[model samples]
Target chain A: MDNSDFKGKNILIVGLGLMGCSFADAFRDLYPQKIYGFDINKEITNYAQQKGLIDEGLTKINSAILGECDFVMICLYLDDAVQFICKNMDGFKKGCIITDIVGVKRKIVSSVQEVLRDDIDYIPGHPMAGKERQGFGYADKKIFKGKNYILTPTKFNKSDNVDYLEKIIKAIGFENVVYTDPEKHDEKIAFTSQLCHVIASSMVDINVDDDISNYEGGSFQDMTRIAMINSKMWSELFIANKDKLVNVLDNFLTSIESFKMLIEKEDPKLIDKLDIIKKSRESL
Target chain B: MDNSDFKGKNILIVGLGLMGCSFADAFRDLYPQKIYGFDINKEITNYAQQKGLIDEGLTKINSAILGECDFVMICLYLDDAVQFICKNMDGFKKGCIITDIVGVKRKIVSSVQEVLRDDIDYIPGHPMAGKERQGFGYADKKIFKGKNYILTPTKFNKSDNVDYLEKIIKAIGFENVVYTDPEKHDEKIAFTSQLCHVIASSMVDINVDDDISNYEGGSFQDMTRIAMINSKMWSELFIANKDKLVNVLDNFLTSIESFKMLIEKEDPKLIDKLDIIKKSRESL
Candidate 1:
């Protein structure tokens, strides 16, 4: 499918938070079509409609209105997304392509596939773009520019639907569209995203009492910039991807322990290790 | 002990590297006088002189020429700084105010005091500013603007000398001049600066093979920006402040382990810990 095919097709976004509103804005900019949205918070849905982010905003899940959407994008927490889909599976239109923007993939993909109709195309996605802040007030259409968007499709997904979704993702301004399986997606994301948040949060958690403003340089600020995270959302993500995240966390702890031992022993090889790390970072 | 008193006074800087040339450039901009420098690398010394960062550059240390300087700033690796001061102790003019720009404080302060004359005021200092790149070629006078300059003075120093050092630090465009004891300075810096570098290096060290450039977001880039560090310099610093740094590192590991347990058990209290971390980061 192309832009002309999506011109008159109705699209539904099942959350009006930052990511959801951002997607709505980007899609509206590309296709110039009506974009409908649903959010549990009436204020957010109303605000998004008022801001012209969505053509129609529903505070409650209306099955009849939802049944008409050609595409449905779920932008809720992992468990909440699974429950929302299971509760409203019959509401979606027949042959409507379903997708999501959740951080984790394995659990969400498995649960979503178990309950979704066989006729529906449920392709899980993750957009590698976010800020330390949250809310629709901070949403921007340019968030997808030059960012990676990953699509994890199982054997159950239709190839035509996957191609249609990829075209829409590219049209929405994502620079790279990576294709992978759910297991590999979750494993890679555990190291690249979730582990970074855990490190930043833990670094900030230990220094609550110290007045670091006087001594903090760019390095400290950069390392902890993501420490101001959305607690509830991240807690859900951490629990959802626990096994992979725990493995990465163990590797990080081992690296840190090695560093500690080198310092304790005043080992001369510490310089060699640091050189290797510097070379590694330079490659990135 | 003020700006006027510093006019026409000779200043000698040891180690014509990034931090050394930055100090020279900032000081020359504030008070244009004879700024002499010494470096083991003749190319760096010559480049600094040609760029007007220093008035005179010496590839080899000359005791006769160095003895006439009114002020001296040693900006070398921690061990090198200590050795340079010890070897050139007799070369400084009588009652000349001496200082250093090394990162760690306790050992530098102790060693400088043990070898210096009673009349020379050897106050240890740390400027909370740097870049990932090294060498005098990347040095800038504006690096110190709106940054913190800390002075760790002991009872062995004169009060008038401390006031003089503070005046020079302010004149260099530093936004804040913090006065702290050596022990407290090391403790705070272990949490704020050194530990941050350790974490960044370790983070990059583990993911050497991953092609992160295609998928990295702002948080990953921010956290690993300082991973491109000077190995020899940082290794000495990490060892010099090992005890305090080890304490902070242990606390950080404990926090990470607590987060792991929360995820492993799917504990609801993870939200509380994340909230506390968010609040702490906001204060920073």
Candidate 2:
């Protein structure tokens, strides 16, 4: 958790996209030794290398490339994470603590753990912060600053792995670090994260037929800014966390039904309900 | 429209809240001849007096207060605009043109027309502008600048009065002013305005809970900025436009169902559906 703890540690960041590269940027500033990176996309690897976000970049995660790091952080897509760990688990350092920057936990933990070597611990960690813009060009060193980072450690995971992951996240400038059971983590995120993108994408989809959309003001644009998100990535997240996401969707739909009843009855109570929500948001 | 056209012409602005006061400020600056204002809240009238937003400020509208204005704009709640006009009709000049800022159209047009004398013309308009912040203190002269101002006129309303109101709106710096039939106006707004607030309020209400709201970020705040809206005022609008609002809510709930199904399938093919929606929005 100190400067000495980070000194001379070799860390491998897999998938040099915005999240992966941002991790390298934050770590490279704090660590004294190697920050290695790998991405299937050569353009992204070259971009991260040209930007000096990583000390070494490889187009593929070969055994030689994966073997050099004391720690490995999987930053690939959910499917890619599984494939990479399965193919390269033997190459990873014997006692290395592996973590991930994936948004969801329940699926990521099970998928990676199934493929990893018994000697390595696959700890699931998510830094709940990002911009609409993606890729290394848009990466920011200050992203995790003053943000909440959640770590989900299963019963099979080593306690030391959780502590080490927390220390890394803390060193990257996150102000709050907490642990939760994997189910609770996914359920809370289904409400807080996944449902948000769904609603945003839905709003934009509804307004597509409106001619006045060309003249949309800040309110409409603000409501749908994330509509441009990488659908491939989010669709994967949505499916991976389907059960919890569906529960959150049910709660959201229930609220909408209550709203419809208020409108149908011409009720004044809707205002007070809205006021309650507004007051609660202010407290947040 | 012109300074000469407005010279010595009296204009009455009912309500004198943010929307009304901003109208008065712009009209007073552009017209400068006679801008009379009325509000149930006397403190608002006194505050507008201190800021010189009106030529006359009165707590109530009577024959004396309404008779002096050549034009009357009802900026009161949708439920109150009709009653406001009915109670104060005797005060209006016999040949004056009346307009309103209420969101719904059919009831407003019918109620106002039923209560008005044959010599007066009732033209309803809704300026597609304003902020979440309400009241005179938040009023600004530039609120309507570059915004779309919708004028909803019934078949019985005079074309000349519509032209006059359009000119006044254009003179006040509104770039685009469109006129539409009353029923169509309400239906379009059901989708555009009322439904937007309902969705925003409901989304915030569902997501914000006791346990994890403190971890909210920009997406949640952006999605629910209008949740901080004046609930009493918005409730009245929703109820008065109940039929249209309910229809819009039904459609929105349908779209939400589509979303739920997509997430449930978690089939990679569903990503194509999201891409289509995303590209459709991008084209807009």
Best by lDDT: 1
Interface RMSD for each candidate model? 1.2, 2.5
Deviation from native of the Cα of residue B68 in model 1, angstroms:
2.2
Residue B155 miss distance in model 1 (angstroms): 2.6
Per-residue lDDT of candidate 2, residues B1-284 (tens digit): 32324677888888988899998888886655678788988888888888889877888666776776788878888878889889877768888888888767788887777777888888788887888778789999788888887787777777777787788888887888877777877777776667767777877787646666434445766777777777787887788788878877777788778889978876666688789877766665
Q: Candidate 1 lDDT, tens digit per residue, A156-251?
A: 889888888888888888888888888888788788888889998988888855568888776777778888889999999889889999999999
Q: Which ten residues in a row have the lowest lDDT in candidate 2 chain B?
A: B208-217
Candidate 2 pairs with clashing backbones: B63-B91
After superposing candidate 2 on the true structure, give the runs of residues whose Cα lies further than 4 Å from its correct spot: A4-7, A25-28, A94-97, A113-122, A133-147, A153-178, A206-208, A214-218, A267-272, B3-9, B94-97, B115-121, B154-175
RMSD of each: 1.9, 3.5
Q: Give the TM-score of each candidate.
A: 0.95, 0.87
Q: Note the residue pairs that clash in candidate 1.
A: none
DockQ (CA atoms), all models: 0.75, 0.43
Question: Each model's number of backbone clashes?
Answer: 0, 1
